[model samples]
Target: MASARLERGVVVGARLLVAAVFVAAAVPKILDPAGFAAAIRNYQAFPYWSWNGLAVGVPMLEVVGALALLSGWKRQAGALLLGGLTLAFVALITSVIVRGIDIGCGCFGQSEAAESVGWPLLVRDLGLLAAIVVAAREPGPLRAARVR
Candidate 1:
C-alpha cells in the first residue's frame, strides 16, 4: 500500500514538473513571438518560410500539452508529445554545437543576452526527456501495485 502511494506521488510529481516546464517555455514564446522567431532563425535549422509558422505553432502545442498533462484526461498523449518535443530540442541543440553556431537557446523569451547553446542545455533536455519517459511508462498507482 505504501509503495503504491509512493509510486502515485512520484508520477504526480513528474507530471507537474513536466507541465510546469512546458508552461514556462510556452509563455515566453507566446508573449514574444517575434523574438522567438528570431531565435529560431538563429538556429538556421529550418527554412526562412517555416520560421514564422514554427514560432507560433510550437508554443501553442506546448500550452495544449501542458494543460492536458495537468488535467489528466490525456496525460499519456501529453507525455508523448512533450517527450518528442524534448527530443527534437536535444537534436537541434546538438546540431548547433556540432556546426559551431553560437546562438541563444530561445527556450525563454528574448533577452539582451540570450543563453548560449551548450552541453548544459542538452543535459537539461535529456533530463526532461527522462522524466517524461518515466512518467509515461509508469502505470497508475493502483495498476502498478497490481502488476507487482
Candidate 2:
C-alpha cells in the first residue's frame, strides 16, 4: 500500500538523521582526543586519571554506533545501544542540573560556553532517544545467526 511505503520512507529518513548526528559528534572528539579529555575534566564527574580513558573510549563507541546505524547492519542491536546511551545521558544531565553543578556537557568536547545540562541538552537527548526507539521498532535488516 501507499501508506506502508510512506511509513518506511519516514523510518529510513529518521535512521539517517540520527546516524548523521552521531557521526558528526564523533568526528570532533576523535579529531581532538586531548581537547575532549579536557572537556571531560570540566564536567568534574570522574577522577583526574579517568578523563583520558573516557575521552578515548566514549568517542570510539560513538563512532562505532554511528557507523552501525548508518550501515543498517545489526540495526536492532545498534539502535538499542544508542537508545540506552541517550537515556543514560538524559539521566546524568538531569542529575547534574538538579545538583546545581554547572559544567561542560562534554558531549562533542568542550564548548565556548562550557555546555551545561540545560534545556537544549535535555531536548537533544530526548530527541536522540526517540529516534533510536523508532529505529529499534523497525525490523532489522540483518540476518539472524543460528546457535546450532
Give the top-scoring candidate (lDDT). 1
| lDDT tens digits, residue span 1-148, model 2 | 4555566666787888888887777788888899899877766667998988988988777777767776878777778767777787898788777778777787876657556677789998998888877765563232121221
What are the models' TM-scores? Answer: 0.91, 0.84
Model 1 over residues 1-148: C-alpha lDDT tens digits?
A: 8877877888878888888999998999999999999999999989999999999999998999888877877878988888888889999999999999988899977877768999999998999998887677554667856788
- TM-score of candidate 2 relative to the true fold: 0.84
Show model 1 residue runs off by greater than 4 Å.
Answer: 143-148
Predictions in order: lDDT = 0.88, 0.76
Residue range with the least summed lDDT across 10 consecutive positions in model 1: 136-145
